[model samples]
Target: MHIELDLNQNDLEALLHHCQSFTPASGDSREDGRLADALQALTEALLEANASQ
Candidate 1:
């Protein structure tokens, strides 16, 4: 699945903050792992976008 979002500085910061704040109990579930991976990917993409700007 592909998703697209157009986030400004504040939006991106909020997203990063939320992702950083998230904690999955025990970190043992498959869904939790997937969410963690997605968050990491999103963070990397956001960093790359900022670097290119």
Candidate 2:
């Protein structure tokens, strides 16, 4: 599946903030680690994509 979003600068900033501040509600270390990793990846990708725009 493919998804696309059209976000303004402020919206991008807000989404980035959420990605940075996210904490998994589950106490499982493995699950939390995966979630954190995914968020980090997303943050990096978002920053890179934003910079390229």
Candidate 3:
């Protein structure tokens, strides 16, 4: 499965902010790991997109 989003600069910023502020519930190591990976990927993608603009 795949998903796509067409986000403007503001939207991307807001998403990054929200992801940065995310806190996983206590004792949920799996979720915490997933969130961390997602945050890293999102940050990288945002940086790459910004650089190409």
Candidate 4:
């Protein structure tokens, strides 16, 4: 799924850089942990989408 990001220039740049530098940490929980950590951004996106409705 594609989610459009709503970030300011500096924040977006940082995010882009972070993704570029991101290498997965080892082991099973790593993926889920990352997703859990990322839920804030996803939640924000959902809120934005809902607000626009």
Q: What is the C-alpha RMSD of each candidate to the true structure, in Å?
A: 2.3, 1.7, 2.2, 7.8
Q: Tell me the tens digit of each residue's lDDT in model 1 across 1-53.
A: 66667889999889888777787666569988888888888887777787787
Number of the top-ranking candidate, with TM-score as the measure: 2
Highest lDDT: which candidate?
2
Better of 1 and 2 by lDDT: 2
Please identify which of the two predictions, 3 or 4, would achieve the higher TM-score against the true structure.
Answer: 3
Question: Which pairs of residues collide in model 4?
Answer: none
lDDT of 4 by residue, 1-53 (tens): 68676666567556656654555565768785786567555555655564675
RMSD of candidate 2 to true structure, Å: 1.7
User: Where in model 1 is the C-alpha error above 4 Å?
Assistant: 1-3, 26-28
Candidate 1 C-alpha error for residue 20, in Å? 1.8
Q: TM-scores of all models?
A: 0.73, 0.81, 0.68, 0.42
Off by over 4 Å in 2: 1-3
Candidate 2 or 1, higher TM-score? 2
Worst lDDT 10-window in candidate 4:
15-24
| lDDT tens digits by residue: candidate 3, 1-53 | 34467889999889878777777665889988887888788777776777888
Task: State which candidate, 2 or 3, has the greater lDDT.
Answer: 2
Q: All candidates' lDDT scores?
A: 0.80, 0.90, 0.78, 0.61
TM-score of candidate 4 on Cα atoms, chains taken together: 0.42
